[model samples]
Structures are given as structure tokens and as C-alpha cells.
Target: MALQFDATEYAARLDRLTARMRDDKLDALLLFAQESMYWLTGYDTFGYCFFQTLVVKVDGSMTLLTRSADLRQARHTSTIDDIVIWVDRVNADPTMDLKNMLSEMDLLGCRIGVEYDTHGMTGRVARLLDNQLTSFCQIIDASYLVGELRLVKSPAEIAHAERAAALADDALDAALPLIHAGGNEAAILAAMQGAVFAGGGDYPANEFIIGSGPDALLCRYKAGRRTLDAADQLTLEWAGVSAHYHAAMMRTVVIGEPSARHRELYAACFEAIKAIETVLRPGYTFGDVFETHARIMDERGLTRHRLNACGYSLGARFSPSWMEQQMFHTGNPQPILPDMTLFVHMIIMDSERNTAMTLGHTYLTTAEAPRALSRHPLDLIVK
Candidate 1:
């Protein structure tokens, strides 16, 4: 099996999960999140687009119900042995098969936890399961149960995150030189991805966010690309993924002499990130970090340019987004813990000036202080 971690590690994760299940009075957990399944049993596969589920009992036993296409995939990538392939045909119902599986495990009348918020559990499929099993079992939304458990990284997981961070730095190093006047955003993006793969890294959960000119002010990735002008700003947000673990980084580069506004905004962004680092230690709530960013930006009169949230937790994730559940935003009560990997981005987008200044990097929370995973300098790069 191509398990990402050792058998002992997988076993320990199962123990932790089952313990949580017992504490919640859950007889079984219906896992649909790829990240949760992978974290628990190293079951790595992209078959989540279709209907798939992993039934994990409180006794630490697991059975994967997937289409036949993923039967070998589950075997090769995960420690799960009892795999059941559900056929797709006209009038075929996988949920019925799932119900039978639960009945066989004596879970038909038990309290079951379901990952209702995951991409794998679509509304249609969830509704089908609910309609079929509501007469037999009690279904509860346990969406963030496993996600909460995964917030803090284990020692081995931290090692993978650190390796990913190094590759992220290397990607930035290789891509920076390509950000010259008249450079192509597509070409720079290609170089960035190539650098990560050349360093034995895997594709990130999401596409690399790369943009130039006015598009630089945007945060998310778009479909098209543009060419850099003689005097323009370019923003990049990408990650280095190793064994599906992610360490993301963001930077805004100037292709020509930066304006005075750019200098001032970049300075505020740098100071905001520095302030964030100080409060990222254990005992601090995720909200405290966002407060720090807000206070710094507010003090600089850049509130209009600031983002609603500063950062979020990072880990092995699937597509649609790389962000995890725990986020650095106002009113969030989640406390920072040691071994947690966070990506804090000080984003300052001045639409009035049509300029963007963003500086972000991943950090590993420690007892003393948060340690930066990337070795790159946080200064604004002006070419």
C-alpha cells in the first residue's frame, strides 16, 4: 500500500477518532470528506466526485463503500481492507447498499454521525441517505468532528508541512526572476508549479492564484491570464504540497519602480504580518491574531484596504479550497495550539489606487512563538 504514514500512525489516528466517536455517543461515523478519510486510514482517492462513504465504527473498524473504479485505488492508497464496490446503473441506489452495510454492522438503529458539509456528501446523496435511513437510524451532522481533530498536526504531519514549506520557498525563488516587464503570467505560473514538482512535491488542493495589473488586487484564481506591463504589480498565492499536505505562501511583486503608495501599503502589510507572528503562540485564540492584523491596519488608516479575515489553518486538503476550518477572523473562539500550521496573509488591496500589497507565509505554532516555515524574506519585492 502507498500509505503516507506508518501503520502505527494510522492506528493511532483511528484510536483518536474512535475515542471522539464514543465521547459524542456516536455508534458509527459516516465519513465523506476525503481529508478525514485520509487522515484516519490513509484512504487517498479522488473518487469523491461521485457518491462514496467510509463507515467507521466506534470499535475502530472501517469499511469503504465506493464505485468499482476506486476499489483498487482504496486498496493501493489506504489501509482499508474491507472495501465494497457499489455499482452505478439505472435505478441503482448506493444508499441502499450503505443501509445494508449498516444493518450488517448492527448500526441500523444506532446514532450515526455524518459529514454533511463535505464535498463528497452532496445534498442529493445526503437527502437520499436521509430518506432511506431515517426510519432505521438517527443521523446527526458531525461535519467538523474530524476536522477539529485534524487542526493540530502530529509530529510526522509537521515534518511533511515543513518539507512543503521549503518547496514553496523554492517555487517562489524560481518564479520571482520570471516577473520581469512584459513577462507572461501563464509562464510564471508554469515555472512556479514546475519548481514544486521538481522538488518532489505534489499538486496543491487548488490552482495557483496568479494575476497581474488590476487582476493582482484579486485573491482567488481566475480562468484567464495577462501579460505584465512595464510598470505593473503582480500577485501570486501558491502552495507546495507534499504527500497531500500543504504549506501556502503569498507575495506581491512590482515589475517596475514602485509608487510611494505602494511603499506605504507594503510597509503596513509587513508590519501587520510581524504583529500577527507575535500573537500566534499557544494560548492565543484565532480571533486574537485577526485582531492584531485589524489593529495594525486600522492604526495605519488602511482599514478600507484590509480583508475581513487574515489567515486560516492549513493541512492536507482536497479541491475547491485549500483553507481549513479554523480561521483567523473576528468572533472565532478556536484557540491556537502547538503544532498547528497557519497561513497568515496581510492583504492590502487599494482599489482607489489600483494597487495591491500582500505578504503571507505559513507558520508552525510553538510554545514560545510561532516559527515561520518559509525562508523567504517578507519584504515587498520590487524588480
Candidate 2:
């Protein structure tokens, strides 16, 4: 079995979840997030795109309701012994199987928690689930329950994160040489991803953001690639993933002599990120971190180019995004806790000036100061 953690760690995590469940007065949790399942039981599979769920009873029993494809998957990758597979047929609604399973488990009238906010639970699946079990049980949105528990990394998880961070550094090493003038986006992307694979790392939760020329202003990955100009800027946001745990890094590399505006924006980003780090300790909140970035960017008159949110929590995540529920955004009262892996970015894109500058990296939060996961310096990459 490819269990990410040992038996004791899994047991401790189960205990923590059950304890949290008791505190929240929840009888069971319908964990729809694949990350939640992986964290709790080392259940790894991309089959979460289908109608699958892990039902966790507060009594410490866990049963995974998935398709036949993941039946052996659960057995091999997870500690979950009780695996039930729902038959697939035309117009099949797996929620019926879930409802029947819940009924058998005597969860029919209990206060059940459903992870409604995750991509694993689609609106169609959620609606079917609600119609099938809402009247049968007291269902509530407990999407963040497991997420909150997974926020603080355990010693074992941090080890994986550190390994992932090393792989990210390796990727950067592979990309730096190829990021100069006339560089091929395809080559750079492949080199970066290849470095991770060679280092025994897993595929990242999302596509690496790669754009050059005017596209360097983009923070998101899009179709089509272009060669780097003689004097161009390239932005990259990629992660090193190990056992699905991510340690992401972002940067904007200058192909030639950086323009005056590029230098200006880079200076602003550097200062903003450094200042934000000062408040990354446990005494502050996630909002405090973003406010720190906002204050610096606004004071420098770069507010329009700056992102509304500086960064977000990172963990073992599934497709569509690597960002966790907790984010560094204004009005978010989530406290900055130690052992949390966070990815804070400083993005400044001035389309008017046709320039871009981005600086970001993941950090493991500590009581005093957050420790940077990446060993790479935060200096502007001028090739």
C-alpha cells in the first residue's frame, strides 16, 4: 500500500477529525474533497472527477463509496478496508448508492457534514445528494472541516513538503538557462516538468503558468505558446509536488536588459513580499498579510497593477487548483497558524506600460517567522 503516512499518523489524523466532528456536533462527515480523503487515509486517485465520496463516521470508521476502478485503488493506496463500489449504468446517480449506504450505517437522521464546496462534489451530484438525504438527515455545509484540520502540516507532511520544495528548486534550475532570448516556451515548460518527474515528484495539481512577451502579463496558463523576444519578460508559476503535497514558486524572468519600468515594478514586488513576510508569524491573521501587501503596493502607487489577494494556503490538492480554502485576502479572519504551508505572491502587471513583474514562493509558517521552502533567492531573474 502506498500510504503517505504511517499507521500512527493516520490514526492521529482520524482522531483529530473525530474530535473536531464531536466539537461541531457532527455525527458523520461526507468528505467530498479528494484532498481530505488523501490527507486522512492516504487515498490517492484522480477518479474523484466522478461521483465518489468518503464517509467518515465520528466513531472512527471510514468507508469509501467509489466506482469499481477505485475499489482496488483504495485497497492499495489507503488504509480504508471498508470499500463499497456503486455500479455504473445509464443515467446512474451514485448518490442513491450513497443514500442507501448511509441508511444502512444508521446515519439517516444524524447531523451529517457535507463537503459541498469542493470540485469533487459537483452541483448535479450535490443536488442529487440533497434530494436523496436532506430529508433523511440534517445536512450542513462542512466543506472547510477537513480542510481546516489539514491546514497545519504534521512532521511527516512537512517532510514531503520539503522534498517537494527541493524538486521545485530543481525545476527552476532547469528553466533558468532556457529562459533567455529566443527561448521556446515548450522547451522551458517541458524542462521544468521533466525535472520534477526525474526527482520522483508527482504531477502538480494545476498547469504551470508560462507566458512570455505580452503574455508575461498573464498569471494564468492559456493555450498557445510563443518564443521569447530579444528583450522580453517571462512569467512562470509552478510547483514541486511530492505525494500530492505542493511547494509552489513563481517568478518573472527578464530575457534581456530590463526596462526602467520592469526594474520599478520588480522593486515594488520585492519590497511588498519582504514586508509581508515580516507579518507572516502566528500573531497576525491572513488578512494582515494581504493588508501588508496592499499597503506597500498602494503606497507605491502600484495598486492598480497589484492583485487583490497576495496568496493562499497550499496543500495536497486535486485538479483545477492547488490553492487551499484559506487565503490571504482582506476581511478573512483566519488566523495565521504555525506549520501551515502558504504560497504568497507579489504580482504586478502593468498592461498600459506593457510590463510584468511577479515574485512568489511557498513558506512553512512558524511561531516567530515563516521559513521559505524554496532555497532560491528572491532576486529578479535577469537572463
Which lDDT tens digits does candidate 2 get at residues 17-45? Answer: 99999999999999999999999999999
Residues 1-383, candidate 1: write the lDDT tens digits.
Answer: 89889998998888889999999999999999999999988888789999999999999888999999999899899999899989989988899999998999899789999999988888899889998899989998999999999999999999999999999999998898888988999889999999999999998999999989999999999999898999999999999999999999999999899999999999999888888888898788999999999999999999988999999999999887789988899989898889999999988999998989999999999987999999998877988
Best by lDDT: 2
How well does model 2 score by local distance difference test?
0.93
- Model 2: what TM-score? 0.99
Query: Candidate 1: misplaced stretches above 4 Å?
Result: none
Candidate 2 segments whose C-alpha is farther than 4 A from its true place: none
lDDT of 1: 0.92
lDDT of 2 at 115: 96
Each prediction's TM-score versus the true structure: 0.98, 0.99
Model 1 lDDT at residue 87: 93
Per-prediction CA RMSD (Å): 1.0, 0.8
